[model samples]
Target chain A: MSAIEVSGLRKAYGGVTAVDGVDLDVAAGEVFALLGPNGAGKSTTVEVLEGHRKRDSGEVRVLGRDPGKPSGDWRARIGVVLQATSDAAELTVREAVAHFAGYYPNPRDADAVIDLVGLTEKAGARAGKLSGGQRRRLDVALGIVGRPELLFLDEPTTGFDPEARRQFWRLIRLLADEGTTILLTTHYLDEAEALADRVAVIARGRIVAEGTPSTLGGRATAEATVRWRGADGPQVRRTPDPQRLIVELARHEELAELTVSRPTLEDVYLDLIGERA
Target chain B: MSTMAVGAARGRLELREFFRRKDAVVFTFALPAFLLVLLGSVFSGTVLGDMSMSQLFTASMVGAGIISTSFITLGVGVAGDREDGTLKRLRGTPMPVAAYFLGKLALVAVASVAEVALLLAVGIGLYGVELPADPARWLTFAWVFGLGVVSCALLGIAASAAAKSARSAPAVMNLPYIGLQFISGVFINPIVVLPSAMVAVASFFPLKWIAQGMRSVFLPDEAAVLEMAGTWEHGMTALVLGAWCVVGLGLCLVTFRWTDE
Candidate 1:
């Protein structure tokens, strides 16, 4: 069975519709990324799937049961790292992670989870004293300590430094390697490209496109842009056959600074976000 | 973890957090002790019926202490936690939301007990406060203290719904509490001597009942003449507090919010 299946999900607030209509399916053990700009209803959609918000109408089956009527056993199998900062400010990192671990049936060792998040050195420090990036790491630790079969990370690396972000990416890869299904929402296109096996770009409360990161928006095999310095000075051409164009250029003249480029994931994402905005 | 185990862990966390802030600890325990000593010393020369003012005021502080330590403390603490997203975080966990409140209650209960102990030690050691020789008086103190703590804890949970943020929690809890103290005669002498309208209004809340119950324990029978209708109204105290308990629990069930929404 799919890890998550949502059909025509709809939610609104008074006069404003947040999630107008949405459908998603994540296969078991797949790493899925939800990409969207601010106000695209990504948070609202995730909250509904997490059983933290009530949807107006739709069918959502997560781990073979409706999240709307979540039980303790069901919650034990899923872990959530929210956008909001963890507020166990008085607790040390180890204490905070240990406390959350007790909520699950089979939890990972708190110390190991702390080390996984690269917080072993600061494990004894109070949560309130940690820097923003360190606190984000601690949040991830608490979320994964439950040994969840499926983990939900909602904009998990908002405040991370470059090194911390790379470390976090590695940790997520390790979890996914162990066959843990992960559903992540992030704004960074590179982060999505580096981790997501499948990516969905949402705009204005709806999914604009969904596919593998490399092929999203037909970028994988789309017409390439060929550029080179020529006798005329400089030249640019868009063609489906970039290799033939390069060969033609070489026969005509010695190519200088020749290059072929394809549109990046960020280029497609911006177009998607802008088209709906 | 089992529900009981979760409650224990949360309770320990709550107590540790409560003490880590020196101001909350001072306000929770020291405020009552300070007030008890101040009132006992100020009224040492006065007597209500056969009971010295020090002894009589000691009983009133015990009632006030229960409300302050348990009811007000929970109201403010729950409101603060709700405002700061702490409760929202816990709601997502497998730990039952009810267990969070259970832990809060446990914290308040322990604080209330310690608060009473502090007040009693101050009263007996310093003021030489009167203590009834009858074992029944201690029994009355025990049950009354229990009922008072529970009823206030419930009401406090309900009252937290009105607090919009952490900054407003103290105001939310204190406004009604200060008013109740006056109406319940915590600051007044000759409680029965108050106008009938005031006494009637005070009867609607648990503070007056708690005060009356505590008074029944510390005072000799002759002092009953100084109370409303020239009697201790022991049965009425239980019935009234019991009714408040039911109403407080109802309000809590209806108004408790895991998030600030």
Candidate 2:
């Protein structure tokens, strides 16, 4: 069953439409990525789904219940890590996590969540005293402390270094492996390609493309580029099938340092965002 | 997710934060005491020609409590929450947004009671201000004090919606408070110095009613000779203050946001 289903979702600020006729379906235990540029209605759509904003028109069902009219129990079943951390600067990390955990019926242990987020050493430290990356991890810890079935991650790693980003990906993968459905929105295409099982690209309040990382925009099956070093120097060819071209060149006994490659997810994403804009 | 539990959790969170903030505690408790001592001592010797110094000090001290709890403390706390996006984060949780206000009011009520107690002790010990001899007057004082705090706290919440930052919150809460203090006969008798328009405006605000209620307790019935009313007029002040409390709470309900802008 789909963990989240949104259809015909619409929202407007004054006369301008923020989320216009948007639709999405995310299956349970699947990692779904929503990719878009700024002002593309990505955050608006997510906010509506999270029940933080009222929708002008449309149906949004999370866990088969309307998100707009969610019961407290329904809310307890979902986790959200917002773009910013909580503002309780005086609270210690352990106190903050424990406080949030008490609201859920079947919450994970607070210490376990803190450990999962790699904040065990900073558990006694005040939230305001922590570094930005540490605070982001605390935000994640609070979100998952509820032991929710579905999770919303909004720009989860915007301020992290390369190593921290990689570590966060592992944590996300671990959550997904535990059968939690994840809906991710991010600007980093490499992160999406690395973590998402399937991705949907949104542009100007609409989905421009949707597919797996390798097959999106026919990236897997499109014409491949073949490159090699000949006696003359580097040579290149765009071909319908690079395998055939490489075999032909090999038959001539002249191809060296041969390589064949297809378009990456970023190439497809840029084209999609560019064309729609 | 339970409303009761969430309310309790919010209250606990507020208490924890309040105790954690040493600076906030210092201001919340010590500032009122310091002001009461300084003002009470400076004004203790002079009868100001006609008015007794203790009487005037008592009324003004009551005003100080209302302004401090309602405006200074509430304004800074709520505006700070808005600026830090704490209110916004709470909106995303299962905890009802109204619980935040409830928790804040609860904290303010307890702390304000402590503040009032501290001032009352000073009033008796140093200023020779007599406590009400009648138990009924003390009962009225208790009810009036509680309701007055409610009205002011609600007003503070309303004022904070317009405040841009924590630094500006004090000014937002104090602008009307300072004006109301004089018109309510806190620092000076209203019948002597206030204009009719000022009296009308003061009657509408909570400070005047709080002073009237406190005067009813502290002053002897014979002291009525000093003012036109000659005795505490409890009915009108209670009615107006009650109305303010109800309306202020309504405004808070209608305009309050867990996260706005």
Q: What would the DockQ be for model 1?
A: 0.55
Model 1 residue B175 CA deviation (Å) reads: 0.7
* Candidates 1 onward: DockQ, in order: 0.55, 0.51
Estimate, for each residue in A103-217, the C-alpha lDDT of model 2 and write its tens digit: 7788999999999999999999999899888898998898899998999999999989999899899999999999999999999999999999999999989888899978988
User: Can you tell me the CAPRI class of model 1?
Assistant: medium
What candidate 1 gets wrong by more than 4 Å, as runs, is A226-236, A250-259, A275-277, B48-51, B130-133, B190-195
Residue lDDT tens for model 1, B187-242 = 77558768889989999899998988888887677777778878888788889888
lDDT of 1 at B91: 66
Q: Model 2, which residues run further than 4 Å from truth?
A: A227-234, A247-260, A275-277, B26-29, B48-55, B121-134, B164-168, B187-197, B219-228
Give native contacts recovered, as a fraction, per prediction.
0.47, 0.51
Best candidate according to lDDT: 1
Please give the distance, in angstroms, between residue A240's alpha carbon in candidate 2 and its true position after superposition: 3.7
Among residues 3 or more apart in sequence or in different chains, the pairs in candidate 1 whose N, CA or C atoms overlap within 3 Å are none
lDDT for each of the candidates? 0.86, 0.80
